[model samples]
Target: MKIAVIVQDGFEAFGLGVLTEVWNEPYHPEDDNPVFDFVVCTPRPGRVKGPAYDLFVDHGLEATEDADMVAVTAKRDIASPSPEVAEALRTASARGAQIFSSCSGAFILGEAGLLDGRECTTHWRYAERLQAAFPLAKVNPDVLYVDDGNILTGAGSAGGIDASLYLMRRLYGAKTAATAARRIVVPPRRDGGQQQFVRTPLGQTEADTLAPLLQWASERLDEQLSVERLAAEAHMSPRTFARRFRDETGTTPLQWLTSQRLALAEELLENSTLPVEQIATRVGFANAAAFRHHFAATRGSSPQAYRKTFSCCEEETAEQAV
Candidate 1:
């Protein structure tokens, strides 16, 4: 694949590093791994001062025209992108080339009109501004990245890594992406969303206040817990507790409990040789059927399939026996 990383003055170093790690780093080349023709392109093509260092790019804006993917690295400035760079990005998009942006680079994509009506994301800090600046864009603040067809927008630093791997997975396959991830010592896939990192001081304070109650709930995922019971434990009325839970966790109490239970179920499925029925009961599901239904709905695979794919006790499964 021909990939062009568009850089500018004050470019973010970590974002570029992620691109290099995924596309440029050599690993198991003899195993028929995908090779990318990666190039760093800038508007001026000479010495450009980034946040960390002044580097020389050999190519200019025109290089993007021939690339299968044009990636815009984040800039510290987050100022309006130069017309020349914006034009190059728009041209690449018009020609069906995949367009990508890391962190604040989504602002540049916004300038190119590529994010119009598209669900996109940026760093949590910039999500509100990105939405205000590009009113037509649906800016989802709680995701690591947004893959809206040809245009992919990543959130903060690590989000760029996830976005790049996602593109690789989409273009190649999970196994191929896993090879690249393994080479870098990163998980082939990460669970949960970026909601885990959002910084809300008020939320944090509320969470701290409810910490003991939450810990108690976490330990009893096997129990069919209710909001009323949790509320009583917190010494607050049910309505007040429900509202506080949403304010603090960004999700309803039920949703949070379900997530906790599902997470435990995944752990047990991967590590234990227990039957599905037992695992379901251990994770607070009403029955094996309900567990199977929710597991498939949330994980896109049955518990048995998940175990087959990730079971640590390999010798205990039917496949291993066979």
Candidate 2:
């Protein structure tokens, strides 16, 4: 993939660092990770002021024209982009290139009219500002990110990582995204629908130690593991476990399990030749019918359809054989 990161004066170093970590070369984000053609550009090919330092950017906005993806790193001031930069982005988008914004970079995108009529997000603090600025845009403040097809916008701080990994998964497949995430030491995936920030108590409670239980439950997806069962295993009362789970994960136990199961199912669909029914059972669904219901609800596709699109081995399923 050819990716160009656009930066400007006052660009948030944290957001830029996160974009670099996910995309810029030498990290080997996939088996095909070596394929990234990364570039950095500014509106002008000269000194650009960051929050703490000045960077001598070598390339100009012209570089975005032929890029497969153009990422806008956040600026603390949320200023509008230069005419040259905005034009370059719109030109790239017209040619079917992906456009992404990390954190408050959505301001630039909104300025360029890309966010108009699109579902987008940014730091919760700036969500109202963004909406007020771009009246036509649908600003979803609660999500970590919003994948509006060609235009992907991330929330504040860690939201960029989530969006970047999602872009990789969308382009390269689940295994590649997972590998890149492991290298970065972040969870493999977080639903974009997940909260921008958890509203849990600031301090960790005794029952907040749910990592071991989560891992254990993930490994035992084939078995029936209810909240009570998980609570017993965690040595906590069921009520305490449920409260702690919600606090720590920002989701209920059943939602988390269903997400985990679907994630595993995605990998199996891409990497294995298992039948749909068997994969369903292995992922803790009571039966294929129930699995199909949840899969379509969450993934927007039936299991067979998902396998057909994402299967990596180039082998045909029984459905494809007909």
Candidate 3:
């Protein structure tokens, strides 16, 4: 695959680093992992100064024309990408190439009219500005990244890594993506979204007070848990407990518990050979039917299908052991 990463003057070094980390670096050469033909492109093929240092690129705007994926790294003066660069991005998009942007690069996509009416995201600090500047684009402030088919937008910093790996997972299989993630010391998959990283108004004291209860609940995901039981454990009435839980966790107790269970189920499905029904029971679901319904609704796929698609364990090995 050919990957053209468009770098402009005053570009963010971390953004370029992530692009190179996920695509340019070969993680498992012994296993014959796919290697991308990665090249840095600029509006003018010459020395461009990034925030920390300078980089020289021989490829110009034309480098993106034949690329399978064109990524716009975050940069300063984001609202004003050169016309040649914008046109190259638009031409790539029109030709069905996968287009990606990290952080403030969403502004470049907006300038190119690629974000119009598309569900996209950027850093939380710039979400409001991005939405205001491009009213036609739906900027989701609470997601790490938004994959609107061919056009993908990532949030700040580490979100670019997540978005890049997600693209790898989509192109290759989950095992291949997991191998890359392990090599880089990042989680193969992360649940929830940017909401997990948002700083809440809750005081540290209040959050600390609920730490034990939260830990206890997390450790017992295989057992049925209820608001009443949790409230009793915390020595508070159900109403007060529920309110305190919301204040500390930024979500309802039931919702928090459900998300934890779903996360555990996903881990088990990916790494273990447990049957779907057995996995459902172990995750505290009443039965396989309820598990399937919730998994389908939340993850957009049946548990069985998800396991089949992402499972890293071998079926023949499991069958022989059984």
| Model 3 residue 10 lDDT score | 89
Number of residue pairs clashing in candidate 1, backbone atoms closer than 3 angstroms, sequence gap of 3 or more or interchain: 0
lDDT of 1 at 139: 93
The 0-to-1 C-alpha lDDT of every candidate, in the order given, reads: 0.84, 0.86, 0.85
Can you write out model 1's per-residue Cα lDDT over 202-249, one digit (the tens) per residue? Answer: 545665777788899999988979999999999999999988777676
Candidate 2 residue lDDT tens string, 202-274: 5657435888999899999999999999999989999998998888888899999998898888888888888
How big is the RMSD of model 3? 3.0
Off by over 4 Å in 3: 27-32, 192-197, 201-215, 231-250, 314-322
The true-structure Cα RMSD of candidate 1 reads 5.2
What residue pairs are clashing in model 2?
Answer: 30-33
